[model samples]
Target: MAIGYQSLFNDNDSVDKANTHKIYDVIIVGSGVSGSFMAKELVDAGLDVLLLEAGEFFSRTNFPKKEIDANSKLYWSGGIEFNKSADLAFLRPKVVGGGSIVNQALLDRFDDMALDSFKEQSGVSFFTKESMQPWYEKAESEIHQEVIPKEHRNKNAEIFAKGFEENNYLYDSLTRAQKNCAYEEGNDCIECLSGCRRDSKQSTLITTLKSAINNGLHMKSLFEVKNIVHKTDEVRVDGIHLKREYESFRAKKLVLASGAMGNSKLLLNSGFKKSLPALGQNFYSHPQFMVLGLFKEQINSGNGPFQALKSADPNFRRKGFKLENVFAPPVGISMLLPGHGEEHQQLMKKISHMACIEVAIRDTNPGSIKTNRHGKMIIDKKLNEEDKKRKNAGIEAINNIFSSQGAQRIIEGNLPIGLHLMGGLGIGERARFSVVTPDFHLHGYKNIFAADSSIFPNAPGINPSLTIMALTKMAASKVFR
Candidate 1:
């Protein structure tokens, strides 16, 4: 009998001494969007590749079904990490598929405004639409995408559209990376946020990762990298296996695909900041806030497709914010709403009559990432004055929409969430300001590379999953060519 897909993962017992001693062509530090696609490209070129992840690998059948279980199992810091200030919460995924596993599956390309800002900031000529079109096309070809039909729009989606129309704001349907959602069977998309049980979502674990494995790529899970030793010709990675045993591996070249926090923490912990002074600077997160509207009739926002529309207003885009129709599980909603005891219970009782809209801001200020003496990652991020102005503008627009729709009460979420994490190891022409070069290699090191959201010079004010895939595809082509 043939082994299942989960058997491809190498645990402590499955990893032999000979495999650890052998030097490979390339070793990637993450198995998320960037690393998985990069592995597929390089493996197709007949190169030996090893991909490592710090989380456990789960098959479709074994994925967490409940909201609390999924949040605790699939994310870092139990699905919510706080900065020193504790005003903002960061949801960073620590699984094999990374953010793609838990995100809303929104797929969007960067517009001219976003690309122009990036090109101007990083001095990269290829940021233009014409230059990046081929790469984006290649990335899109690897996955299936679809737009939610008008007939399937839920009450929440209808409310969003009506509010936008009544307020004269432009909106559009969202394009998602999915296969067969099976809406005819009355399946709820909110339930698939943790990990799609039906394998409908086109996450890297089901797309590029499967192809890479078939092309002879080696993958190890639950192996956390603790240190990196860069040699003249090879790179050695040392880490703990299952939190106790020591394991090390060597490769001719290494690529860091861990997100902004993971990459910054790893580099700072390994003492690379001495050589690369800007290692952890320029960190950014697209801060998002939830605004809820309570209605007299039952909206049942969580019943069907949870999200279907996004703000397409050029004015809103230029104003540094976008609105989205979204809903969460009961556990998440409870956390978002304020009050206690009977007050909280009353809100929970009206869950079926609530609709939500999220304001995602394009933050102007950048923060820094550092490590204390204990080697724990410290994230120093805050919304500057300009960011606050933009957020307030978005909130005002949402309030107008709710009032126009005759909302009984409008509630703004107290906590600000950081979902689109970017920067830290930004890429640029000058080494003084950036950690990575335009060609996606470290400034001082030639054998190490990175091309994930960590290298993004700034926020794009749009969904970044598709752009990440495109950038990594371009990186693979340029690095190998």
Candidate 2:
């Protein structure tokens, strides 16, 4: 009977209206970092929690060691997809761990200046540092957060660090959530994209999910929630319509954490609110580009951790948020190379000594995420004008860093890709401007909640995982009560 909620996705006839109608406390959509954190919080608060994930549960070992396989299989849009233009490729994860499994594990505290801007425009007072600082601190503690020690860094990082010194820019080793450390200096590169094998990268799969399961939380993976069913008013959440192969399951109280684009399309298809509009807007891609460095010496680039060093200019928000950091998995750099044949082979020769740094631009351009009639998600976005201006600036920043680090024959290229796509079902003031409220509750739908990047009113222009954890922790505290 404990598996009843999970069995909903396994059998179509199990939870039919005539067979049985059992209502539970919470049905949280998504098993990503935020949802996992919420599941733990709610279960610890003494509530029966059902976590619905659109993807399969993947263990760390389940990931492939090769970067290409990791990208094609674990990534959201199959490692590459176009965002408004074919020249750009957007990378999103399809696994339950979300981007945590593949991301460079760059943890950053959002600038108060950016949060203040959101508060000023959206009238959402929760965007202040003083209000959210304790929550961030608490989340960080729960995640066992710490900056990567210098000893764990590779030669490429030291080189990049020198660039910061030369330019008078502040550089700090980025924070990562790994357990016991077992990283080597330069060949640990193959592990970054495939998910950490050393129990080192403490992605959400090992962190909060472990806590939730220990607390008796039920996780339903490979089950996609199709529609929300409402049984009159008074709002007990009633139940959900979900799919597992050919069958469907139902639940009471639905939580939509299906990323920004996924949630917006689902809400519209469910007919939650048709004329209300603005269901999927205010979206940001955090468009990313890479600059590769091939040094004169055989400085191994593939070893150690991913992105041990990072530098960001807080003032970049006006131009655009520019984060510069070295990347791992020597082969991962090949995808970003712009030329073919001889030119590509030349870069490949020194690949062993190669390192890369990426810049994820936070832009304000509005985009739309909708589902086609064929049940496929579709996203259309215009490159943010300001993002275009920052592209070169971002490349220049990374290039300068590499130069300072003694990199030679540096190559630069932008991929048609982005990560941490957000704000499809954005939370705002009135029904006219936004679909969801600041609390992540939809404007007209009660008990329906969103706990993912979809609720982001503005791109924080920083790596969003920890920020998502902090916000969802706050959301659980406010909504689940």
Candidate 3:
């Protein structure tokens, strides 16, 4: 199916709202972390910026404090977790702030190992911990990064750490992006599954998007960009053709930050995929597995950011870089409790004290995406032998960590949620092999650029948001000039 189907969702009823007067210098697709930062940076540099978001406007009030939005107004089928298969569930958030709004807000920096590993793969040489260190500090500072002391840690977490150290494993205080912190005793992260409140999460909603809006960056939520209209070899990205919005509009330059899935669909639909064959190839979804520990004491694992601590042993290596990690949430506590009767009831009562740790692995798995016969973007991801092996190793390491930490009993969680989606448009030397260059510009299209995770040379076995930010900033710095 043609990726241009986004046109079907456009809203053109308000022809009167069309801006016949001014032309924006740049049009940014998706208002997530990168898009918001990109728009703000462009506008701050005196460029007319327009940012578009496919989801609705998520304000402080409209958003729910519920554990999951499954029953909230923003609850959409696609927004909630869904697996291509009925027995599985894939986690992805659809809203104004993008994944940043729904994520655990683990604002970690680019470790040296991750940067180096990515460089050797597609010859993407510019990404470096030193180069991105400044951005990291800035990002972390903005997010209010803090290291949770042993004092604030909940009883369960503190005990878990001790068990690890007693077993000769070094586990330090886990840092997190939060305002009111307390995980020492395994204090539960109250709103993690939903989204952090108290504005302490430091998500893009409070940082990039907030700043962009404050700087006159025009934002249009619920606007999905469907096509890129080219006239006279000049690129004209029409605002997505929606069922209820603007019919068509123009922009000088287009920046796509709609994320791996969304950007891949838009590019393939716009016919850019024809020129660059690797448009949606080399897809990497960091296979993640969680190990939950059910304790007899009241842990209250449900309280804080879904994840506040992480394990960093068996460093992930590709070329010469070491992978970094934080903590996982207490998700499996429900199932791991002792029994089906009174035992289960008592465990549920003490669920607050339960905690979990995850081993998230960035694999070499290569997956492909295809537009379904119906024209909707369908992701067909398959894990090969290599991916399976890597996943197993990651699982082993995670299980070991949990055991060392004195987890009473452990069981692998349900389908591993693939959070880090990447590689539809990678940065390689060849156009046929790579859709975009290390610079994130389309191989043949000079005016069109993709600044999302689609440009990842390969998966770096860690959170992609920070890397996404660095790459987007790098692209905007060179392309916008």
Worst 10 residues of 2 by lDDT: 11-20
* Candidate 3 lDDT, 111-229, residue by residue in tens: 67667767776776676777777666555554566676544555555555655555454454556666654444443555543554345666677777666666666666667677776
Q: Which of 1 and 2 is ahead in lDDT?
A: 1
Mind sharing the TM-score for model 1?
Answer: 0.96
Candidate with better lDDT, 2 vs 3: 2
The collision pairs in model 1 are none
C-alpha TM-score for every candidate: 0.96, 0.88, 0.83
Sorted by lDDT, highest first, which candidate order results? 1, 2, 3
Task: List the candidates ranked by TM-score, beginning with the highest.
Answer: 1, 2, 3
Q: In model 3, which runs have C-alpha deviations exceeding 4 angstroms?
A: 1-22, 70-76, 80-89, 134-142, 180-193, 232-234, 238-243, 315-350, 397-408
| Candidate 1 vs 3: which has more TM-score | 1
Candidate 2 vs. true structure, TM-score:
0.88
Off by over 4 Å in 1: 1-18
Residues 230-323 of candidate 1: C-alpha lDDT, one tens digit per residue: 9989999998867898899999999999988889999999999998998888888899999999999999988767889999999999899999
Cα lDDT over the full model 2: 0.68
